[model samples]
Target: MPAVTEPKLIAGNANLSLAKAIARRMSMHRGMSVSLVEARVERFNDQEIFVEVFENVRGEDMYIIQSTSNPANDNLMELLIMTDALRRSSASRITAVIPYFGYARQDRRAKARTPITAKLVANMIAEAGVDRVLTLDLHAAQIQGFFDIPVDNLYASPVFALDIEHQFRGQMNDLMVVSPDVGGVARARELAKRINAPLAIVDKRREKAGEIAGMTVIGDVRGHKCIIVDDICDTAGTLCKAAETLMEAGATEVHSYITHGVLSGPAVERVQNSVMKSLVITDSIEATEKVKAAGNIRIVPTAPMFAQAILNIWGGMSVSSLFETDTLVPIYEGLYQRS
Candidate 1:
């Protein structure tokens, strides 16, 4: 039998902490020894980006872990340059591991003369010589179709469902999973099914970007502790409004679990003043200081999930099983059995 070689991990500056965490998990995996391939990503005096891989990756599989977050353009350019560098270094496979794929929200043209930026971003990654893409909870799942290369769209529902089970445990009946809008109903329904909770939708009309014109609850949330589920929370205008609407509909308490917490502009301030009991988000995108200081906000690390997915992909194992959603009965049974 031929000896197997470990895939080289590369980190970009988009989210160093997350990248490091994934690296640590890789190193800790039994029978697997992995390390990040050293690389220098800097800029010239004229503000041009430069990337140089120090290690020889000839014919080796390499995965570049980056999140196109806050500085979207800079981080995106860095990823593309890093991919091109790895390609030039003769890496057999270059997978762009983007935890928070920026510009994913612009997957469609909402109006005439508008650009479908997500498709363009996908094209850029492919043109940069990437063989595959691995990302989490894209705003639009169809963005995967935009990429010519193989793209794995991982879901955060498993993590959130496990947490929900732990938090609500015996009180699952009191919980109601909610979709902030019709578009997110599918996501919220999956979460609701996992927790064995009823589902509700907040029918909202968007008159302008980053703002909601009006919102109406589509189902009864009266006396239920509602949990709104969504893929992203950018300005937080919609989430805050949905929480308020739920409260007005007699929901006992409103909580939320979002995959990506962009939290741009006045998001933190709005979340602070919202009627939500708490807002839990995944650390797909690095959290800002304001998000860190917010009393009502909590961040859950998603590094373990990503780490497992990366390992599975490198080992040629199935990644779909990693996203299997949990149900209340099984969770309860396992918990009791463990005790």
Candidate 2:
């Protein structure tokens, strides 16, 4: 957080709003003259990808801000070709500024002969000549090991923690942090610690893709306020179900927090009708008009966080301190204690 030399930024065909916000945080305007051209991308009467980068990026330290959210293949290719273009143009260094890394859930071979697609994506990005990576809230932390180059995985909890303090002044004690599923218990526990609150877990099972069922409460929920935390909320399947279960288990009120807001399918309608009092998510992915107008959903900004992270990397500062929480582990130990 001290004075340091700043790096220049360049962008591709990504989330221009978030990119501009990041630029504003750094006290710079989006660069001019450079363009991201759609390079000969045709379906070719068959399905395949072709790409080219039209501008020269010679001797620059380029940062391509692309989120591989929905329409994953197109965004992935855009990132790869943009990096390749910068490399070929003789850019001194390139960093992929991915706010939401796609396919991160397929981190390991869950089934026999299954592919580790996350590693493959890392390999592809590295092959495209990216010098390093800057991403946020990867589905699995282990995916950082997939990259050969330097990888900085930033956290959104500090931003959320600050907002929670501002949003619920003087009533913090009534709050309880809830993880919508077993996997996210650690994250919810961390947030609970930052705010100095209790933790609860929803033991839900995935009956099939896009289908969530069986919510079992792991801790006391009678009359306590709830805030469900997750890494991503795509279909609203698990989130809504968990909120319903918590209400049934006697929660005073229910709210949800998520990292990426990929509100696809009937998600808009699902959230519209759910028992959740509200849902909050970060602006890593651009929300649609429906997501924007949805009465229950609110968006938190990530521009300042990414801006600080960019500064940290370019200035040789430690990024790990951003998390500032040993809180989650201790809370988990308490919640799992023998009855």
TM per candidate comes to 0.94, 0.86
Q: Which portions of model 1 show Cα errors greater than 4 Å?
A: 1-3, 31-33, 208-210, 325-339
The Cα error of candidate 1 at residue 144, in Å, is: 1.0
Model 2 misplacement above 4 A? 1-6, 28-56, 206-210, 324-339
Model 1, residue 318: distance off in Å is: 0.5
Model 2 Cα lDDT, one tens digit per residue, 124-243? 999989998999999999999999999999887766776676677777888999988778878888889888989999897768866665779999988988989889998888788889
Clashing pairs in 2: none
Worst 10 residues of 1 by lDDT: 330-339
TM-score of 1: 0.94
Model 1 lDDT on a 0 to 1 scale? 0.88
User: Model 1: per-residue lDDT, tens digit, 312-337?
Assistant: 88888878877775322232234322
